[model samples]
Target: MIMPQQSSKNSGLWQQATLLPIALVAIEILVINGGMILDMTTSGTSDATRVLLMDSPHWFLLTGLVLGASEILAYRFLVKRFAKRPVTELGATGCIKETALGILVGSVLVSLPMLILWARGFWRFNSFAINSGILKGIGIGLIACVFEELLMRGVFLRLLEQKWGAPGALVVTSLVFGAIHLSNPGVTWLGALTIGVEAGFLLGTAYLWKRRLWFPIGLHFGWNAMQAAFWGGNVSGTGKQSGLLDGTLHGPTWLTGGSVGIEGSLLTAVIGLLAAGVIWKLTPREAPEMAPHEAKTPTDEVPDTGETPAITASEPGRQTRRD
Candidate 1:
């Protein structure tokens, strides 16, 4: 049986592990809804006009900004109170460069499979046009990727690592992340599993390799935004999206990913897994340093007389005796 003190300690640790993610989710929902309600009340337009305005690129961009700010503030406050470590993951140093690299990587990952489909005659493009929908996709992708990376990589995975180490934490977080997407509009069991394995490993390794959030955030945003911008298809089963290219996908559900978009395709999963392996190999193997409070103290050495010896600075070879 566990002792009372041990049980209490375990309970405290569990709370510490869980509280931040839950609070962050709560803050996100509250802010998003609050923004919507405030918009609805202040617009004073007809119902149809209000709906159109809410769907506009400007509205989404504004919401993304507000929501991103609120989540960041909450994350900072919670980490300072509980983890007691500097928020290095969200540090601004090299963020732009790293994020740009991530975007390029993400675009490549999604592009390869889509290109394969197109070459096989499963996907066809009709025309191209510049439109506001691309901007809207950008806004949606920004909000989603930032919110997810902050919660998943910044808090949940990091906390789990404290107890389970990196490997175990990666596994748990991947499974949980995939499970969360199971509720999406067209996601199937296989799709969810693939997401858990593919995205989980890809994003998780990205974080492990760099020890920063910007890379993974940019990667995620690039994937979703590119899907909407180029293909005019569903992204992660979020439903149809407007894109700059007028196109249609026609093929077996397994090959084309059907309503779930390219993420559900077997080819995408294979490519993503390979990419994840490459990232994992590049990741450093060293464990992160312990927080100051969590570091172990060195035991003092005592002689047979049960007195600790201290070296004297004044004498090169002398030991000081304690009274």
Candidate 2:
């Protein structure tokens, strides 16, 4: 029923959609596995020594640094080669301020739910202490938050937006993000769904708000580090050996969020969605004018400002010359 040219066009479109994401993921996996192998080799043949090294906060910090640098280089290479755009998402300008704001927002969102649960007598703190666990938590959070934001927002969401527009891209990315966590220990269907909806929109809107990766990365790191290391709660479904504050929840799984931490709570969902809405409202409707000194590619008719174009429901497939 289809003409050869039309069928070929469809096939090309499909390949275009699938290729970059697949390649990026593959590169990431290879980097991670290679790092693991390197760590094992350096730690020597004894299982005990390897385990000890792996658990050390210093080691985690070292690994995070290595992995972070590697990922950034890989991301920059891919974006430059395939997307033919400047790597402005990882721009250093105002990064500290944006990241700090994100950390504050994330801490507040997590705190509100815990405060409510405590007020209602559903939760209680057992103890407070500071330990190396906090450092380890920071290391883990840095690596994870950076890696995920790069892969999800930097790569997947950006590419999808090019094809499906912002709204459709957000929805698709959110679902995929949630689905990816189904394999995490202790995650339920409900838990994964909550993550998809709350985190997806929250992170996506953060990118839309500033058109940079720092805010979302800081937000993610703050949430996970606070929940697991500071608050003494499970993260996703996995429990750490220790946290700064030892706490217990005595309530329904729905209210307590069970093993998935506060991320699974209804209160968190409500608050996260509210925050996302506020961010969406605050997002600029149009890209700001670029400074005259800003870098421009030879192929660009207009300077690439790295800002997301104004999204409209009616033009889901509209193409723009800028990133």
Candidate that would win on TM-score:
1
lDDT of candidate 1 over 1-323, digit per residue (tens)? 98564555455456656887788778778866765786657766677777787778877767777777788778777766766667788777898999999999998898899899889999888878888878777777777888888878877787677788889989998888888888998898888878888888788888888778889988998887788766666889888778787788888888888777788888888888899899989988877655444544453233377765654655677667643
Candidate 2 achieves a global lDDT of 0.75
Query: Candidate 2: where are CA atoms >4 Å away?
Result: 1-45, 287-323
Model 1: lDDT of residue 140 = 75
Task: lDDT for model 1, please.
Answer: 0.80
Model 1 segments beyond 4 Å from truth?
1-16, 299-323
Give per-residue CA lDDT, model 2, range 1-323, as digits (tens).
98564565455435434654566566557655664786656765677776786678867666666666777777777656544456788888998999898888887787888899999999887988998887777666666787788878876786576567777888999888888888878788888888888888899988878778889988988887777678777777766436788888878888888877777887788888898889989988654222222334475366678976764454567754533
How big is the RMSD of model 2?
10.8
Candidate lDDT values, in order: 0.80, 0.75
What TM-score, computed on C-alpha atoms, does each candidate reach? 0.87, 0.79
